[model samples]
Target: MPVRTSPADAPLRIAVVADSDTRWKWGALTARRIAGRPPELAGFLLRGRATPTPRQLAEVGVAADALREVTMAEFLRAAEREPYDVVVLALVGGAAQAALHGLARLWPGHARRPVLVTGYVGVVYEKLADGLLLRHGADVVLANSRHDAERFRAVYEGVGADAAAVTEAALPFLGGAPHTPEPGRDTVVFAAQPSVPESRADRMYLLRRLIGHARRHPERDVLLKLRSKPGEHTTHIEEQPYQKLARSLDPPPNFRLVYGNMGEVLDRTDLLVTVSSTAALESLHRSVPTAVLTDLGVREALGNHHFIGSGCLASWDQLDAGHRPSPDPRWLAAQGVAPGEAYEGAFDAVRARLAELLARPALAPVSPYYTPVTAPGYLPGILARHHLAPDGTPLPGAAPETEATGVRRLVRDAVRDAARGAYRHGVQRVAPVIRRMGEL
Candidate 1:
């Protein structure tokens, strides 16, 4: 393959591929931040179980120069056909790995490929090793905080993989004015996750507590900041929605469910509370009096364990008693919550690394850790899920017809809707019953 080179002053053409609303927000924002100047941005939303709806995209409010939905195979084909300065894989671990391997196959030998980047959307509490290794082959694997960057490097080095790819960066969505106490009405927002408190009972318990808090303090406006509506899917599967749980117990007028941009909601919020959502970090970044609920216990399963030393842990009882938790300054700094210049410069390293990569005469092929030789048993299954062979070639019938039209398009949409409905039904209705039966 011939060397693919471009002038240093040329405008960058960046592409971002994301799976869900949250990742899309992270990817789009990160792309802009690292682009140095406004570059040509193209967004690809992967068609998957958690594909964000139009409403979800609107709620996120991050626009790309061009946006479309594509399957993993389709995206590979597009990448092969087009040339991009940078490609951000804002996908889950398996999908990212699949794409990396497939891109390597498409752009083999000395062919210059785009600077590949992948990272978590927010706090990294679960699947440290598995996820990190899957994202190992990206040219840059972003770590959202210093703490995470250290852990990511440790994991890669421990596994005998290159640790140089771990780049320290802050979550792209972390920005808002410092929280100011409202003079007349104190707004308390509970940031709700789709599946953190997975059980109906646990969700009901939290809702009842929120309602109790509202009843106890009628003067204060309590808001349930929901991530998604009943039908919309997010990063995680919402087995039991708080909206449905709230209906069982009629809540006070002052307490209501609200959905929109989290930053906008945080603008008026005095107290922000959550189980383990990334909203806690966002709230802390803005100096909001944030609380991580300990009612569910600070267990790893709940992910509140990540806040163990942050000094933000509090129960509903404590919150109701007017005990607002303040984050430790040291913890805040380590978590990349530094305000002003520090926050602004978080993506500086990423930009520099990208500039270096893009300036190279010819780059090596995408070398993911999980290859046919490395994990013969596991790698193939992951690729097969995305309709790619172990060697990264698309399987038969993997590509969809070019833009289904008329009746065909309508039928396709209907089938997708039915599939989504079935998934929701299984999650919200059937899964809980099965779990209860297992408990017996």
Candidate 2:
């Protein structure tokens, strides 16, 4: 039996556990829209780069008290003190996956163990293993599109996940009405993924292609939008920065490196290109000419093979020939790109489902396999010992980083980077082995 709580008297308390700006943005937007007046929102972020940026805070207009940095142990401790009604995991990484497994272990049997919801921030094609874990770990998994939801459902069924957990939801980062392409703006933006900027050879090839495109269309202003500023770490550490390449190449006057508001940049952008980014999808939603560059093979992480047959890709040859990319009507319908009738149906369904969840005062669905005692086996024992106890109590005096901890982290990062390079180069044969190493 569901307890119909009064929205005015007792607002639903939501805790957004996130470690990235992209994920936090989604959580903040959802809270702003869904949390009734006098918002009961607490944004718990991990320390360092994961902390919400001032710009991000301004964009969402999140209350100062609402956003705070907390260590994993601290967050767990606070949850034990006063649990939220809903815990939204705004994460999509190995760390987040591991954290979810830990949270599942720590919260079971608690009186106020909130319903957990996890979601991807953007397009997901080849990352099925993590996707499966996220789906099974959370009480509800938010899918960005109908195609994605169906795909996740099929995978969840295959993985023996509870079939009732998935729900289709729009990405809150893309909040405004559908973008209409403006006239007289002949700007082309290559949404750069500086973090893990493909292979060195691939990077050079892409730069050369963009340069060639600019040469062919001198009237077009081409902007290379960087993922982060030089020396700044965001999610993945970039071994090679595009700024260095841009400086060496000495691109044409029309070609420039850009970093600022993505929406504003897209407003003036007539054409958008990327290896595989959420930006490509955003551009498509705006009705702009969007191209998924696939000079890299389908097997490569940046291939973006999902859009291959969808008519959104500009292959190496296509880029060379200066061909205009077109979107497949059927693909758009299947992908749930909106302003269409299909999107409206999906959006309404998601809102209705969310309303039903909000109506209930508590969301506690326990899993026999994920109790705190069992979670340490899935994650590293060290993480479990450092973060929480079997009875959901956070370990004391383990929250702060000491000098020794900092030194150890530096060494660990170097090793991880080396292993990542080896994995990228195909030196590592087993996917599971690499996945486990990634968790480390």
lDDT of each: 0.89, 0.64
Model 1 ranges with Cα > 4 A deviation: 1-7, 434-440
Tens digits of per-residue lDDT for model 2, 76-188? 65665564666777765544554565566565553346667777777776666555553466667777787888888887677565667678766655533455655666788
Badly placed stretches (over 4 Å) of model 2 are 1-11, 33-39, 48-65, 97-107, 110-113, 175-183, 316-322, 340-345, 368-377, 389-393, 400-440
Q: Model 2 — TM-score against the truth?
A: 0.78
Instruction: Give a tens-digit lDDT track for model 1, residues 1-440.
Output: 22345676766888999999999999999998888888888999998889999999999999888999888988887887778888999999999999998888987776677899999998888899999999998899999999999999999999899899999988988888887776795999999998788877788889899999999999989999999888778999988888878887889899999999999999999999999999998999988889999998888888999998899999999999999997898998999986556798998999989989887877787888888898999999999999999899889878764768899989998998899888878877898789999999
- TM-score top scorer: 1
Report RMSD (Å) for each prediction in the order shown.
Answer: 1.8, 7.0
TM-score, every prediction? 0.96, 0.78
